[model samples]
Target chain A: MIGLYLTAPYLVYLVIVYAVPIIQGFRISVLDYVYAAPGASVPQPFVGLKNYRKALSDPLLRRSFLNILEFLAINVPLTVILGMTLAAVLAKLSRMKTFFRSAFFVPYVTASIAVIGVWYFLFSQGGLIDHVLGSWAPNPSWLVNSKLAMVVIALEVTWKQLGFYVLLYLAGVLLIPDSLYEAASIDGAGPVRQFRAITVPALRNITILVTTLALIVGANLFAEPYLLTGGGGPNGATMSPALLIYQKGVEQGEPGVGAAIGVLLTLFILLVAGAGAGARRLVQAREAA
Target chain B: MRNGQYGRTLRRLTTYGFVTLGALASIFPLYYMVVGSLQLRADSAFSGLIPKAGNLGLQNYRDVNKAISLLPSLGNSAIFTLGTVVLTIVVGLPAGYALARLRFPGKPAVAGGLILVLVLPFQVMMIPLYILAVRDYGLADNYLGMILPFAVNPAAVLIFRQFFISLPDELFDAAHIDGAGEVRTLLLVAAPLTKPAILTASVITFIGPWNEFLWPFLITKKHSMQPLAVSLGEYVSTNAATAANPYGVILAGACVLAVPVIALFLVAQRYFTSAALGSGVKE
Candidate 1:
């Protein structure tokens, strides 16, 4: 069929770029993984999950997982709370909606590399934020402080990404009927009460969506750590699994080890994202009731 | 009535106060970035929240030009973005059209494959793809090497297919009944309807690679071959970290890397509405 001809390019593209590589990734993960150039006389003997065992016990890789855990602890709540609250406010504004929307949204469109520079400037020692904080700032700067560096990265991710999530929340908020708010108001409920009972409950599904989306993105925290922390620095406090993959696999040319990290990270993402998807369906079913 | 009036005023004030503060928080960094780029300062920090006309100049930009060579990198970014976007649309549009309208035998299989790959993060394939680009394919430091992995986007195909499928079946049926060939129908009839999808796909695709750093950074060992983001990324990690951190130069590079996407956002923002962003996130 003409259909087969038409669709072949993408299928072929996916095969070469995604499927085969996934297979290759699994193969490499189980091998000893030569660091040699193409066609070099090196034997990559089957290691049979030796790399996986090493990756699990590897300090930086283990730290990378905990690093994301800390990142998620800061990023998820901040993103959801800030996003929906901003959305709630935006919903109330009858004027300058477009202006406010675009204001929040510009950073989302800007390159992380570009704005990570601003983040660097803002959080650098004696910079605007530090000057504003005025002696409350951490010693050795936020960039160099082991404890604060990950926190800064989390905030940067939340700030750059919060706008898009706010828009998502805004769309969800706009769908809840005005009549519910009206009824709540008539029942002697103030704005806060109405939001608590009507708005929050109505947007429950969106909150799940927003939270999981944030979780999925945060798990693969790469550029923010890579660029902002200069490839996960300050004693590996900012090291992420994704960055570790680049370092071990690409930069260090230890494909087997990197592939092991990659496979584990992939499994972690799939499990969490899968659970999120399942939760979404459960929420939908409950709402449909 | 007076109590109600007081409450109303308080609520409005709080609403305005929250939104104003949030908006300022969101947008000020960019305004400051532009300000930071233009200023000449010894320490290379932000001069202040506001730019003083007396302190500002093109000196940092000049330094950026000398340091990173902005023009060639911009050209490289443009070429990389164009290659990926054009190739994606070329490959994806036809495939989408076929899957949506034509009776392909593997249509179900393709759809299943898409669902399977929907949540397939690029991180999963980064290693092997890097190997393919660098060692196996010998594409290291090459333009095609930098662009090849991103050339075909599954999300773009999915978006195009969904958009095409949304159109009425009667329309495609009529074109087929007219004996117009599939290609002709796509160009003349179906293609016109796909403008929104095309625009959405193109813009979304543009931003992803336009702002990308890591992959290209991996592909190119040479500074000259690196795109704008990679060059700036390399700079910030190295030169920008030293005691001689060039604040103006860094922001100047950031400005070059940032301005195009921001400009595109401003010009075509209507297409970047919540609906499109929702779909675009699949990228």
Candidate 2:
């Protein structure tokens, strides 16, 4: 009875709030749901996988997936490499480490909307970027230019997220024993050689972990693009899968299509996450052998 | 020896130089935001790295206030964030404890499922959740609509569960001998012991609700109901064509929104880093 009392509130909250909605969400996906036609009898017709078929067939959906793929391709590697490099420096720093660490990490803690606000100013016409460009070339309208818009958004994500990756990498680097570096140094290995042999190998798991997280976060890109490009503007140049899902589902009132896209995106994330876990296990086994 | 010393100096200089450049690249956008916010409309046209000190006035700040009810929006954000944090912790703590300590059936499956949920995009589940909220539950444009869906954070529960599992079993046994029930023991014992984990979870929970854009934007259309992020986003989007971008006022707003989390981080920097990184590890 006591145990039941202890667990009841939490159990009830989770079931009612978290689990039920998630399960109900699946059910709603099957129905021809319309938020506006709320009182209509049998509002959502049970159309099994029809939404999924429409979503899969949509060119916008395919394009958004491709856009997310391109974004991940650039962002994942840049953030990881930059983060690892900064972490390496931070690990070696003997003075002002905390200050430097905090400075880099301020962005991660700041609101994403705020960060996007700052970027909007910098990337907009006659803003910082344009100001610089006016010195040499004609000012390009970044928010409207389809090709440049994606790159600008990508850069913004990298800048905001690099600090987080740095912290993660720093934790991994700190775990490497100093004696390993000493041993390499005594063996006539230079700093580069030490890092190549010791730091890289030791940080393998951290790399995989950070990369997977970056990919997941990157795939779910919404606020930045939504705010930055005005909901994937310039003919949908920077539209992510998440934004596409929101636009189709909420704005267009197509819950079925939205759920279908959502499932597809979830599957994509799951495959990446699974591959990462598998890779970590493989690395650990190889190291043990 | 002298040559080697010179080489070491050169290497140190190179390292410092590279790190400094990266740091500047990381922080330069923020610097621009600050400078741009301060400049007058005419000065803003120049877009130089440095702001003309005279052009730095309260005009932007005044404009931002006139344009949006930033203060009220911030209040709404705080209420929502605080409410969400309390709800998550109140519910998450016991559930985490149950999963960690109790020999419940489907424990491993529950644990694994929670982890899977963490990686699943909120976008996918959003439509169904929204339909349930508006159509079935009739929570449209209401605070409950926003709060209920977000209350049970999977990540918080996972972190709390991890922390709970590592706790010494003796504490529970001792409390049990004293005739303290599981609820009493959890409230008095486990909850206090997991301070760092709790604080970390609270900070993250606060940040998510405070910084959340899409959900609030989707759910609430009323200016009174909107939080700081959505309100500010709407303000910027609508006011983009104005001569001066009102950078300072926006920065001020951003700064206001940031202050609590920044302060929390500063107070618990070391523990915050450890807890964040520790919970992130797979094992």
The top-ranked prediction according to TM-score is 1
Residue pairs with clashing backbones, model 2: B37-B247, B37-B248
Q: Is the docking of candidate 1 incorrect, acceptable, medium or high quality?
A: medium
Error of 2 at B1 (Å): 3.2
Question: For residues B1-283, could you state the per-residue lDDT of candidate 2 as single tens digits?
Answer: 9998998999888888778787777667666666656666534455356677667776776777677766888788888788889988887877788878886555665666567566666776777777777777777777777777678677788788888888999989999999997778888988788888888788767768888888887888899988888888877667745635556667656656666676776776776574465574454
Tens-digit lDDT track of model 1 for B1-283: 9998998899889998999899999998898889888878733333466667777788888888887899999999999999999998999899889978889788888877776666666777888888877778789898889888788666788778878878998887898899999888889999888889988888878888899987898788899899999998888777765523377789989998999999998888887777666554433
Please give fnat for model 1: 0.74
TM-score: model 1, chain A: 0.89
Clashes in candidate 2: how many? 2
DockQ each: 0.65, 0.53
CA-lDDT, candidates in order = 0.83, 0.76
